[model samples]
Target: MFISAKNIFKNYGSTQALSDISFEVNKNELFGFIGPDGAGKTTLFRILTTLLLADKGSATINGWDVVNDFKTIRNNVGYMPGRFSLYQDLSVEENLTFFATIFGTTIEENYDLIRDIYVQIEPFKKRLAGKLSGGMKQKLALSCALIHAPELLVLDEPTTGVDAVSRKEFWEMLRNLRDKGITIIVSTPYMDEASLCDRVALMQNGKIMQIDTPQHIVGEFPRKLYAVRSSNMYSLKDDLLHFPEQHSVHLFGQYLHFTAREREADILGLRHYLEGKNHQNIIIEAIEPGIEDCFIELMTENSASNEN
Candidate 1:
């Protein structure tokens, strides 16, 4: 494994940021930590990158212990934090050069590894890091992170706040990197990106709700689900919430996933109920679950268990 952690725990003042966190990433795999803002992703990344100490448990990257081998880990892993921590006043070229120099290497030494990613932003190398657009900043950060050619790369929500096209471009670059044998561990709040990962750890409130290939996770959704829509969209959702056989009902983009009490939900009864409620243009179809659907199901189960 390129990255591994066992029973990790973290806290801040009166709050627990992580609870018994554990996972492993194999060499050359694109692993994702998928969750919302406060899901302890940043905290876990910080611990793995040797920036913060975990209250318990241990972690290693590329066979080096994160704590005891702090210096070696720091030198051997490329870390791109969630926030832009590069020197804002510095030019893009200058920032990349500075990082390479600090690592006792030159940009020319690893130019081949970064060329594919760096070329997109190279034309604006003279622009100040702060003056660059959000997309450009993202590229520059990625380029700097890869300039050292570390065996393991850790990125925390590298795609947040970027445009759709830029996000697509960034993930493509990651794929190319992983193809070249660099193990990558990235975190993202966007559920759609989960499909791009070889495996994902669905996290929430300092816990991993599920960890599996996106296909397997969605396949394991334990109920028949339907995408439901009607003329009265808002009312349709409200009515579904109070549905007699509803196991779960939540909006999924343009459609609402209606999981019934069992796999054999009453389609006829559902239609009749909606029609009786004056709903028009009702459309319903059995649909396969997506990563978000699976995550929502796991989160619901966790909530129910806690309440019990």
Candidate 2:
């Protein structure tokens, strides 16, 4: 395993930040840790990168224990934090040079490793890192992280605040990196980006909800689903939630996504119930489940089991 974490636990004051979180990343794979904000993604990343220690369990990168071999782990992994942490006052070229110096290397020594990405922003080498656009800053940060030619790359929500085009470009850059035989372990809140990974671990609160390829996870959605819309959208949601046959009710775009209580749920009865409630222009059509849908279902199941 390129990366391995077992039963890791972390705490912050009274809150349990991570609980028995365990997963492994294979060599040369693009593994994603999918979750929303405050889902303990950053906390787990910190522990894996050796910036923080876990209260319990163990983690290793490239077969070296994170705690005991912090020095070796730090040298072998390239980490791009959630926030841009490069020197704001320094120019892009200067920042890259400084990072290379710290790692006992020079830009010329590892130029080939970052050439593809660096070329995109090379013209702005003299520009201050703080003055560059969000996308450019992202490219520069990645350049510095890869300057030392680390075998593993750990990124924490690298595309969170960037524009849509920039986000797409960033993912393309990641794919290029993966092609270079660098193992990547990234965390993101965006469900759409999950499909791009070789495998993903859906996380919520402080636990791993599920781990599988995006196709497999979506393929395993256990209930029949439908997309519902009505002239009175607000009232329609309320009516569906109150419907005895609704397993779950959630908003998706301009429509409400519903999972039926039973496979044989009465579609006509549901439409009539909405009509009786004065919800005009009613439309309910069966649809396939998405990754977000599966995530919600798993979360709901987990919460209900805990309550019982």
Model 1 misplaced stretches (Cα beyond 4 Å): none
Each prediction's whole-model lDDT (CA): 0.93, 0.93
Per-candidate TM vs. native?
0.98, 0.97
TM-score (C-alpha, index-matched) for candidate 1: 0.98
Report the number of the highest-TM-score candidate: 1
Error of 2 at 49 (Å): 0.5
Residue range 1-308, candidate 2, lDDT tens digits: 88889999999989999999999989999999999998999999999999999999999998999999999999989999999999999999999999999999999999999999999999999999999999898899999999999999999999988899989988988988999999999999999899889999999999999999999998999988899999888888899999988899999999999988796568999988888898888898999888899999999999999999
Please give, for residues 1-308, the per-residue lDDT of candidate 1 as tens digits: 77889999999988999999989999999999999999999999999999999999999887899899999988888999999879999999999999999988999999999999888888998989999888889999988988889998999999999999999999999999999999999999999999999999999999998899988998898998899999889999999988899889998889888989988579899999999899999999998888988888899899999999
Error of 1 at 13 (Å): 1.4
